[model samples]
Target: MEFKKFKLIKQMQSTIKKEFIFLLFAAVITSSCRKIFNLPKEKEYLSNNVNFANKILEPVLGRTNLIGGFNGDNSTQPIHFEIVNARYGDGRPVTDIFQKAQTYVWTAAYTGTEKSLAEIEAKRHLEEHPLFEIRSSGEFIMWPSATNDLVTPRPADSTNYPQDTRFFDVKITNTGGERLIRDFQIRPWRERPYDPADDMNLYTGGPAPFPETPYNVLSRNYIRPSRMDNVVGDSTDIDLGNDNYHRNNVLVYIRPFTGGNGHSLRFKVLNKDSVAIDPALFNETEWVRLVHGFNLVKTKEYVQYDVAYPIPLVNLSTIYAPGGSNAYIELKYSRTGFGQQRVTTVLGLNFGIYRAGDWEIVFHFRKDNPRFKDE
Candidate 1:
């Protein structure tokens, strides 16, 4: 018993040292750890031949307005901001989804110390668009005049334009002087919607041939192409275990104003049309987030899930999205500060349309209510 007690004391001492080391590292990491936004850390991962998501889904300049009018009266409401109008890089407006636009632009030219020709033109364009015609009371007009409608977005190639949107003074300013300033990134598949499977399926030779190149297919190894345990002619099928291969999982892409923050995003699967799936089809409750909280690393980024995602083998393609369809999911995000202070449930966002409730899952082209908090 004495020997056992001595061993236990030694083990406890060792454990205490490990715990202390872990806490010290975690604290230092919290402040200086950089985000993983710059992709493909090693030169080996980036290939001229391969097409990565970062290449295709770069952030595009867009518009956002407070959902309802910006109410400054502190007695009436808490200072809230949201995004209303969304547009694409190619000058296509996302009216079907959010369906509202802010009438005003940043007034007073953004005079940078040293400017390029592109910068001069972009700022000139921005100055032309004013937040409100009236200086005293400025609210976004739902019905924009023909003059405002003619105002076009900045040229896509212009560098560092729209970086600062503090053109107008808010009617109600908080202690931090926080306004509706934000970065609006357009979601992928604005015009053309394709299934995840389509992105994964291998591209076989077709029109225009290999020289022209139609390579968008994923690896077929997960389908179990190899024979079982080297049994020469055995018919038994076997799956070579791969713990967390992304190709066989679900991919969720998200964005944020800041990077390198810890947050958790909870989500549940639904039908393609943004409607709840039936019990026979799927249970949104089974899809509810459990003990395995899907934590967000380095703020907003594409997250891939493995066994956590369902794979119904009986019908094969029944549980997930069908070949031609897309999978719809509801998302709710929550984050705390460095000292574990509870931030607002709706952090720095109001999808620019809904005024009363909070929404974080306004992704996809569907126009239905996100119902992010209800579920």
Candidate 2:
């Protein structure tokens, strides 16, 4: 009985020792893992406030063309920008402007959600009560370019047009949304001399100093067709007098309110002829072709004007006769004047589709009287 009791006590002691060894091993592993995961936070050289203030100082005080800045309000001004190879640290290479890096702009307000920078710029204007946060990865800095001709318009009558010049103030803001205003002067870089009698170049004389005009100025107009519809009969028939044949063509006339030159006029054809004749003939035919170029009528002589005067030609596809398809016309013209002026212009049209046996003709303004001005 004494020997059996001694053996039982030995077994209990061995079991306790095994459990204590296992517990110690687990504690060591847990402590080591905690130390491995605890990393130190990264430090930033520039604070948000310092970065925000710098954008305003460099442009005005330093007289630097390139300055880092941001827009507070979602105005036409761009937002979120970065400059490259800019001066940093104690001693860095001071190179020419070519040393600069590509810059990027971000909206002042952003959500924690992931999104692209372009998506942010587009939505920034529409967002209400948006919050933005900005940070640089030490890769680049943001700066503005030299204030030159940021926007320009082509001369209306290149041969006779006097140079159009305008001086406007540019308003800039920083990350904190503080604004900085700078005056920018712009004038037409005329390639030729001006002649008032020459209808071809009415707006261009030579490079002139900026004139007095508001910076944010904009202009618009409403055009009305003098006559909606007219009819023509057989080829031999002269006037047709609105009877036997159908006239599907309409005329639109435009008049401007503001008197400056170097503005563009755009026309959008919203609706088209719905008459259905034949598909095969319509496909082969060039339905929309410039019969006669746009003409400006003056008291002395009528001048033929090419569409490529103010802006580059934006070519549109021809419309087909099965008649459910729609097309549009966008015409851009620039004008320069000393004061308010009125000029009459005409667009010749041929809207009817001809197939051997059947003819399709229809006319209605889908969206008429819409005009925009380039300021």
Candidate 3:
């Protein structure tokens, strides 16, 4: 028994020597790696004179809008922000801007690759949110359900559109210190979401004149019928309509058809004869990833979606609206033409419908059917 005890002690000593040698080798390797890499220590950043470039904010009501123009010069990441002294245009103290209401919030990450309603619901949740909020990144946000006419007076009449304003100060802070940006102006406008004219007049709440751009290809009446001409052996000879056809064309608008049973949006297309067009023909469109909707239902008549209200839940540009602040839907198809050449055409629109309902947007080809035949 004593011999066995001595043997056990020797075995322990051997094990300890091996472990000590391994640890020493590991320490040397780590030190050498650190020295060879010449890694610098991370420097802590503090915010310096942070200012917002867009001191004048003009957010429309009834939609989620992010207020940008954060000019944080030499500021650390994730700078904290708080709204201070929120009041009306006349400097009266207000609390409506801070009141909470039901709003949609993302629970999981939306990677824009979700395939079904189950996936979308898993990523989103409804929560109560303030009317206006300042995020930690020194940006402001106006929630979807915010509507305070007292702070932002509505137009008395169509001709009497007003630019009632509100004033507030922002308290910006970081690990370094805090600074107050005083007298920031907010001139809220009524909901004028989406557009062929993307920018609505702040004074008129109507279509604003198109901004000067050499590449502006958009039109207010984009979904109009093609003009017809009687030319033999020409594709333009397809008798869609005369030039005056747009005056009596089929109407395209959004209206509720579900009696407000659920939050739903639908789309439909019709030929010149007022007959439904098969949605499957738009082969180049992404139905699943279209418009951030879920539970897609395609039929002979229309394509429907179970969507949250205000068409676009937020005004920011996303996969649903690549240009941001507008809802864009692009439909495309291709056909084999003469000489076996494939021809492709893309038709798109950027528009918005702010009111929540069981809405359906119809596109009726009143003049002529889209030419799909080969020469």
Candidate 4:
């Protein structure tokens, strides 16, 4: 019995010794961890004072629009943002804004120097995403795929008023708390397909002239070696009687021409009688480097090119676009007058087309045929 008692005591001592060693090892590890890497305590900044500016968001359909109205105030970094309760102006729920959509995202870098449509398209990949999204950084993005069916546009007339609008609430949250900006107005506008857009009211879709640089087409006459007293400074300056050049004399129209596969662009100039003008007369035009197009075909009637859609593949200055924003088309011809003075008439237009299609731009000189003969 004494020996058994002594054995029990020995077993207890062994267990206690092992437990003490384990405790010591744990303590050493804990102390070393603190000494090796010291980290500051996480901060929780309350967003109670965080607010958004009272501004109406007007996103245009068929284009990507960025929303700006966030005022961080005293909010901390990494605040989360979400669109809550999206609805029409009449309080009807808007389910389309949250639905998944196939959106084109750039998979590879675009330097605006892509040689082919294949090269440009290969850099992009389509992925499913929401039509509208708000980032954690308070940046709101309305995807390009947002159409008229997805959201209501501003009414064009008083009869349609009070019915055409969209509304939503923004929810922002942080570790401190959450905030809701109530009844934020969203007045979406109809799609304006191309940039350098015509003067059109976004709310009413009515004719509204731009205050400055009203038109996109800049057509002017260039007179070299100084102008004579008898010679008119501009084509529009003097009345050519039947051949007068008015601001609206030339009518430019874009129509779909499905001749060159899917992506193609063609230019056609027509006289007052609707007869096709020889494109070769524009001698100063660089046929080879006219645009980012390949497989150029020139004829007496029209100039066709196998081009990548959107004229400029990207929104950067390249040989294709000198301004980096709009596609510029220049047509030029020079003729010597009575005094052997050189008169160069250069017609230029700065414009943009976003939709992908086989398209043709026709310039119709409505009043009279351009004088190409020397006096």
Poorly placed runs, candidate 3 (over 4 Å): 1-48, 75-80, 148-163, 173-178, 193-255, 259-261, 272-275, 280-296, 308-328, 334-340, 351-356
Q: Which ten contiguous residues of candidate 4 have the minimum total lDDT? A: 222-231
* lDDT agreement of model 4 with the native: 0.69
Q: Model 3, 101: alpha-carbon shift in Å?
A: 0.8
Per-prediction TM-score to the true structure, in the order listed: 0.20, 0.16, 0.64, 0.72
For each candidate, what is the lDDT?
A: 0.27, 0.27, 0.66, 0.69
Runs in model 4 deviating more than 4 A are 1-54, 149-152, 158-162, 195-247, 258-260, 311-313
Highest-scoring model, lDDT:
4
Give Cα distance to truth, residue 97, candidate 4, Å: 2.8
Pairwise lDDT winner, candidates 2 and 4:
4
**Model 3 TM-score?**
0.64
Model 1 lDDT-worst window of ten: 225-234
Q: What RMSD does each model have against the real structure?
A: 25.7, 22.8, 10.1, 13.6
Q: For model 3, what is the error of residue 123's alpha carbon versus the real structure, in angstroms, after optimal superposition?
A: 2.0
**Superposed Cα deviation of residue 268, candidate 3 (Å):** 1.5
